[model samples]
Target: MCCAHKNENRGAFIVLEGTDRSGKTLQCQKIYDYLISIGRKCIKTEFPNRSTDVGKLLDGYLRKTIKLAPEVSHLLFTANRWELNDYIEKNLQNGVDVVCDRYSFSGIAYSSGAINLDYEWCKSKEQGLVSPDLVIFLDINLSLSSSRSGFGDEIYENIKDQNNVYEVYQSFSNYSFWNNIDASQDPDVSLKNC
Candidate 1:
């Protein structure tokens, strides 16, 4: 059994979330490397992990070669997270900082964007999973983000889809523990704030 009270120095779980081209990937890497440089044990990972079976399905869905219902895709995304829950929990327990590029919030935003599902329905599936100690949201202007990195062939990479997801993210802004950071500045400045 896991002890409720453990060492005070247990590592923190940090999640970085943002729209595409919002610099979240770079920020996640920077944070992970910084933690390592400080002698903290850390592991960085991303959602739609693309390594597991469920992730493979998600990859296919994103690729558009295989069609899945919006709800089904949402469940798959949730299940992918479920697969990593234990690993994340154990790592934190062992004093390892787990840095995630994207997480449940991304799932909620992206899935809810694709389908008009209840926010409750989207959030309910993640209720008991370990929550991040910190969630840094790299908020970037939609047009700027899209301009930096043009839309890809992925299912949710278009302007319309991104707009919807952005709204969804805004809707849940109050319910979760998140820090919204303006990502329009230099990466160094962004990292300093985050």
Candidate 2:
């Protein structure tokens, strides 16, 4: 069972995003563990919570088991994020920081790759959603990302696709909350920067 938050102020909403092999998950886990050890109130969550019904549909689309139009796929991904909005808001309101593995940026970049969805348009589609207070981008180049172990076999797992997404992510660097970290570094170094 979980306990109530001890702090008075709302908790921070931190998001981890990046190209493949960017160490988002690894860092998130490490951060979660450290926070727990130190008794900081927090909750670790992720987009496409596949246990949920909407996420079940998204799982099929991601796995190529279900054929969806790019537009449909984009909406499903957005819906997947929405599925967690209430929980995220409630946690943050209670002062339990939320570490999210992915959110709107992934939706925008990945969806654009399937077709010609403009970055701004993709951003607009996510209007009214709860934005992350901070977004840590694991910056990894195409070559390095491809060479990483366990590079996925999924639809958006190729050099072209990855590169496309990288470019799109790059385009969003102007945002004040976006923080880019050199993902090629050792885990400790990356974690320190993150």
Candidate 3:
């Protein structure tokens, strides 16, 4: 519902948000591929990019190699998104849609889920970052989520944590720009909704 002002000619800034193993990556890739096929200039990226220094730090934390306070970890995730704000803006300005696998919403939901960190606090940390023109939430239950191929490889992998995260994601259902797709369905059917 928080729509930023942009020129009509600019490409859309799209975000794909969901809990762990919700098929966000696969669906995002499908959206990107379709956009390309239709001749839309576009680029796809994910949060905690894992290529930059902060991202590497995040990766380390995800892999359980380093330990930090929950609040600190959450801030790092928000910072990772801030790190890409300019790039997102640039792509949109140049008429290239920026499709993100995860954005500040995930940082807020996943980090605050079952934690002392407040949703408002986590949201405040990402205030200045670019907001998406469209947010597609891939809705799938935690059981099916854990059944995914790479379910437990990183942090926030368990059913309990994912359940809390899923609850937070549900809170965004009322947002005007948000759209929920049953990710448990066939990929082609899900893509059709996209």
Candidate 4:
């Protein structure tokens, strides 16, 4: 992982990462809500934000409307993160906690796992991006995740690709700030553990 420039007074930057149907979106909202309920200043955001121009291309790629080579797609994903780095930095510097649905790790995981790209090269793309204070990875077996609602809706939602993605996520288990949660558990249980 790249060393990020952290501010002592900044709010925590937490990111949720997982394979398809792994409940990252739901967890991100729940985390944000919980933080707010406790009177914490928090905001929710997501990667491949699907709002900026680069993100629009990413959205198209995810939705199967646009096709890109693995290398190009990987760079685009990183560019999308770069597009929002200032926003994340600003909120954090202002002491607003950020609960982001995805981030650079997902970029590396998806690109390297699904497309067999070089892992180190994929990681290099994220070199200067802001690193999260915590990375909550919702871990679930491929069989279980594949059975979840809306499975296979996206291009990389196949069992084979997800299995590869799962392995890639597993490889991140050693990161000091990474936490693995059993996503197969009940939402409340997962949330409480988090």
Candidate 5:
């Protein structure tokens, strides 16, 4: 027989994945807040966190102010995640739940969306990073997603790129821990199921 308390100390690593304007940021905040309200130890983070040097490069690429080669940009994005790998692992090991706005999935989808890099090539850079225990993928149709505000700013924010990223996210369904949520529906109802 297993001890019921043995698993209590392993905090959940929850990752929110979605295309641009899919309300991932808001939902991550909501989930984080809800966890806190319930008195659970929680921490929230976002990729391209923009606080680290690697993240600064990613922010520049996203803003289109700096033009790095697609491959190089991809590496920088992966490096940004690597920069946080230790923190995330330690937090979870300490039983602090982590809610991430984006993760390796974003790295793969965004890079593949840009340079048409092989999926494996996009994924290889992220190997050995800790995987989220639960990945909540918010699915928003391209048509509906495009209609939302702030959809046309960055270098890779166009419909073509968004569609490609959506396809890439779909491939993640093979992972048993992935949960796909339809964001086109009411947020409250979606949250209930998420």
Candidate 6:
């Protein structure tokens, strides 16, 4: 079994993680819609939520309007997620499935991959958070992801950083809860795999 800590009475916590433009958002929506249509309680959410106070800083950083040291930026990202912990946990406990577009995995992979931060330290910050019941990683090729529309609009959207992040994500494939889906496939096919 996966190392995820789950309560049998709680709804599943599912996370979809991948590089920018790797269709995480889309798949999240698809999964949520499917669940809802089938009479399941589900909500779709994304990390670096860009709505909270910390998320506002992260949004500014991502939009190139502000600059921060790599470590600080990474912490800000983690804090942003922390801001949502209560909401996520409460929903799960209420039997509402949570479909998150990204989570701690992205934070660690992006920070470690993009700026060469210590992977262990990056992982360490994620302690004491709700673990996903299932993590679906959309595995898209860097070249194809880079060529997608609006690819270079944000940080870590380039090929080199993405390649690094992809490698880091690959390293997590051995975990039983982690599912890797080929992002290059048709949306229907990919959704089916998910």
Native-to-model Cα distance after best TM-score fit, residue 98 in candidate 1, in Å: 0.5
- CA error at residue 96 for candidate 4, angstroms: 0.7
Worst 10 residues of 2 by lDDT: 1-10
TM-scores for all predictions? 0.92, 0.91, 0.96, 0.95, 0.93, 0.96
| Pairs of residues at least 3 apart in sequence or in different chains that clash in candidate 3 | none
As for candidate 1, its clashing pairs are none
Where model 5 places Cα greater than 4 Å from the true spot, the runs are 1-8
Backbone Cα, N, C clashes tallied per candidate: 0, 0, 0, 0, 0, 0
Give the candidate order by descending TM-score.
Answer: 3, 6, 4, 5, 1, 2
Instruction: Give candidate 3 regions above 4 Å deviation.
Output: none
Instruction: Give me the displacement of residue 135 in model 6, in angstroms.
Output: 0.6
- On residues 116-174, what C-alpha lDDT tens digit does candidate 1 reach at each position? 77777988877777788788888898888888744566878778888888888777567
Model 2's alpha-carbon lDDT is: 0.80
Span of 10 residues, lowest total lDDT, candidate 4: 1-10
- Residue 66 error for model 6, in Å? 0.4
For model 3, the run of ten residues with the poorest summed lDDT: 1-10
Better of 3 and 6 by lDDT: 6
C-alpha root-mean-square deviation, each candidate: 2.9, 4.5, 1.1, 1.4, 3.5, 1.5
After TM-score superposition, the amount by which residue 174's alpha carbon in candidate 3 deviates from its true location, in angstroms, is 1.2
lDDT by residue for model 3 (40-141), tens:
999999997999889999999998889979998998888888888999988898889988998988888887785558988888898878878999999987
Tell me the deviation in Å of residue 113 in model 1.
1.9
Each prediction's whole-model lDDT (CA)? 0.84, 0.80, 0.87, 0.89, 0.87, 0.90
Residue 129 of candidate 3: its Cα lDDT?
83
